[model samples]
Target: MKKRFRILVTGSAGFIGHHLMLALQRAGHHTVGLDALNNYYDPKLKFRRLQEQGFNTEEIKYDTLLSNSTLHGSYFIQLDLADAPALQQLFKAQAFDIVINLAAQAGVRHSIDHPEQYVASNLVGFANILECCRRNRIKHLLFASSSSVYGLNQDIPFSTSHRTDEPISFYAATKKANEVMAHSYAHLYSLPITGLRFFTVYGPWGRPDMAYYIFSKAIVEGKPIRIFNYGDMLRDFTYVDDVVEGVMQLLDVKPATGKAPYKLYNIGNNQPEQLMEAVAILERLLQRKAKLDLHPIQPGDVRATFADVEDLALETGFKPQTSLREGLSKFIDWFKMYHKINEVHALQEG
Candidate 1:
């Protein structure tokens, strides 16, 4: 029988976190969601996702209560991870069984511009979370790591065992730092921890900063989309639903003996798609061609990423099965519906 206890999901307003909360609620697990809900992206999109899950923004502080949904013990809280005292207070108030740390400063390019935000959210904020977990004696801690940690390695399929000493971006470096930090805590405090290295994650209610979403926006607005690296970059674009499924499967199962209760896995489609190829699929789905301005690759960027999911399969029997075409179609359909862009436009001139 699965153990049922109060679960805390930081970054509940995020694309993955929101979906995970819904999945947890459907499975009858009590959950608490905490997110800063900052204007990093469009806050309206986050609010809409929360609304679908039966959370009213005005009421809850550290957590929001579910009113009409099947979730009997689910709540959402607008909180920042940097607030150590607030996090400590929450841990004191609730007896949480698991803590999924998804709240962090995301984006490779943004990290270059604002290093302080990354330090505050990913480093200091994570330190605060670890302290709270140690104090509360939380059972399991699952935190979000990124595939960008793979850096500039020429390895065809990136594996967890690969040397991750090289990180190109501050964002990737921070994620790497998180793994080291987590390992230290797990080793010292005997805390069970799992770090997930996610590839290019995309789907419904996804962040606008992502390539897929940004390209779609540019295509719709008839604006020229910048094809970085002259359309040479490659990414293992995993669908959001598949990511959520893998996370849900791993929720109860923590690290075990000989594994430090601290494990890492590459959560990705395992099929790397070329930059140009993804754009082609998007154009096909939207029935509109993107205005392209091919440019050289920017700094803090890698040429390709492919996840070796052998370890993930061994751990949770988790396999990413979504194809780019199917996933992109779903996202485009939702985007059109959400933005009320009902009619499809003719393909633009090259």
Candidate 2:
């Protein structure tokens, strides 16, 4: 018999968070999703995601629990992690068996402009979560790290054992701080923690800021698409489904006792696809020719990213199975339907 656990997933309304929340609900787990739903890109999309989970966006109040109508086992709360008092109260009330902290101020370039946001959310918010888990006695703590943590490394495939001391971007630095912070909590409180360094994750319900999503929209609207580094970038684009699968697999599997029970792994597709090749695939799928706008590599942008998933596979016996072409096809289908590209030539014209 499978054990049905009470899970707390932070950032539940975000791209990966929404998918993960639905997946957990479907699997018969009592899950609670928490998100501030800040206007990083579009709050409407975040609200839409919450709405799909049976939350009425208009009625949602901060720090209040919103129950899912369709799935009795799911709930959502709109709150920031930095609110220590509220978070502590909720943690004490729920007594969650596991926590997956996916909430963070994402985007490297955005961090450059708004370093304060990263400090507030990624640092202070994360600290609050760690303290909550310690007081609540969470069985296992899993959080999202990033491939950006491997900043400036020329290594083909990034590994967990690699030295991530020198982070090029503020976003990456904050993530690295998360790993160390979790490790300290694990060491002191004897908490079981796992940090997953995710590569370029994309698929249906993807973030609009991502290159693939932007490129798709531009191509559909017959607008020029900017190719950074003159289309010389490489990325290990892991599909969202695959990332969820990896998370689900590692959910109940706690790190071995002793040594603070701290573990880290890279969750990504072992396959790295070239940027131009991916654009070509998008063009083919969308049936449109993209006007090429070549540009130099932007600050805080890495030339390439690949993942060494052998450690993850060895521990969990799981590897990402979705091919890039197949994943893009699914994304394109969703994009067209969701954005209503047929109704208008440009959804959000720049």
lDDT of 2 by residue, 1-350 (tens): 57988899999999999999988988899888999989999888888788888878677544444222223377788899999998888887777899999999999999999999999999999999999999989999999999999998877788888889889999999999999999999999899999989899999888999999999988987889999999999999999999999999999888877878999989999899999999999999988889999999999999999999998899889878899999999998888877876645556421
- Give a tens-digit lDDT track for model 1, residues 135-168: 8999999999999998977777999988998999
Deviation in angstroms for 340 in model 2? 1.0
Off by over 4 Å in 2: 61-72, 343-350
* Stretches of candidate 1 exceeding 4 Å from the true structure: 61-72, 344-350
Q: lDDT of all the models against the reference? A: 0.86, 0.89
TM-scores for candidates 1 onward, in order: 0.94, 0.95
Candidate closest to the true structure, highest lDDT? 2
Residue pairs with clashing backbones, model 1: 64-75, 64-76
Output the worst ten-in-a-row residue range by lDDT, candidate 2: 63-72
Error of 2 at 112 (Å): 0.6
Backbone steric clashes in candidate 2, count: 0
